[model samples]
Target: MTLGEILAVAAVGISALTLWDSHQERVRTEEKAVATADRADAEAAVLVLRATPSRDGDRLTLAPLNPEQAIQAQTILFPSALKLPPVETTGDPRIEADWFAEPLKRARKGAGQKDEDPGDQRLPIIVVTHYLAGGARHTSRAIHDLGYTLEGRFLRGSAVTLRGMSIVRTVKEEGAQAALDAVWTGRHRSAG
Candidate 1:
């Protein structure tokens, strides 16, 4: 080939190699972003799944649904609005009457006066659970709704029940401690 043709061929080859390198770099960057997002989603899911609450009668306990994950500590904080104390335990904790029964009764009474259904009353409580999984410590916050049923003649007997529970979010150790402090200090604020 002539000198000009040879030079053109070399330029084309260099351009092709540079294009390939740029394409590969873009692909790698995309893959990394996808992997990071997937990891975050998985961690959130783990927090949600591990903070499941189990209730028996007037008692409640939080444990991981998967046996592999074990809870290190758990705290149940009645809303500051409810004016109830926080309970800390490593075992199943009894649902206190003040935590739900009294507030529910009051709500029911208020609803009755307003011509609303007493059965629609609900009390929300925050639960924090600490667990170690995959060599990392995870703290999760779950909001549980407490309901009550009035039974017997004239609805004299009242029993507290667990209406529902949901994992709202996960926090760092410091944030979790701050939440506990907020509740224990009797501050009227959102813990999580």
Candidate 2:
């Protein structure tokens, strides 16, 4: 081929390569955007779990914080339509499962004491294990401190299988005490 034809061929090859590289970069950028959106969605779901109380006080409520997230979380956390109880959080690390389930004053005094009334409507924790089918372990830990929210109900039931408890990661910017103080002191709620 002549010199001009050779140069034209070379130019075409270079142009094709540049276009291919640009397309690859665009694909990567799109993938990154999708991944970022997924992370944001997961974070929002986690926030709902941390900030809101249950609706029926028996089934987990994602209300008042972000309703759409709460509904989505309910589907994500309990897909089988299992009944999960409401949770009450406290900064006191000493508070475990029993007293939350039943008052200390109601402890059994004599032998052969039966469990408290199930109809009492107290909050029962519904646990989600770290070992899920997919990559949920990563998202779950990102939201909470990676402990069960309720104390003892991790692995006692026939239907439920739990390995560890997960708790909400207290906002360290304000300290653990302040986040909880807002809840009990009613500062988190608006004055209506």
Candidate 2 lDDT over 1-192, as tens digits, reads: 999999999999999999999999999999999999887666554532432223322222222233433221221221111222323332211223332333211222122223432322121123221221123332222223212222234466211111222343434423433343333223112210
Worst 10 residues of 1 by lDDT: 183-192
lDDT of every predicted structure (CA atoms): 0.55, 0.34
- Candidate 2 CA-lDDT value: 0.34
The segments of candidate 1 whose C-alpha lies over 4 angstroms from its true place after superposition are 1-45, 49-56, 93-99, 107-121, 152-156, 168-192
Tell me the spans in candidate 2 whose CA falls farther than 4 Å from its real position. 47-104, 108-192
TM for candidate 1 is 0.51
How many pairs collide in each candidate, listed in order? Answer: 0, 7
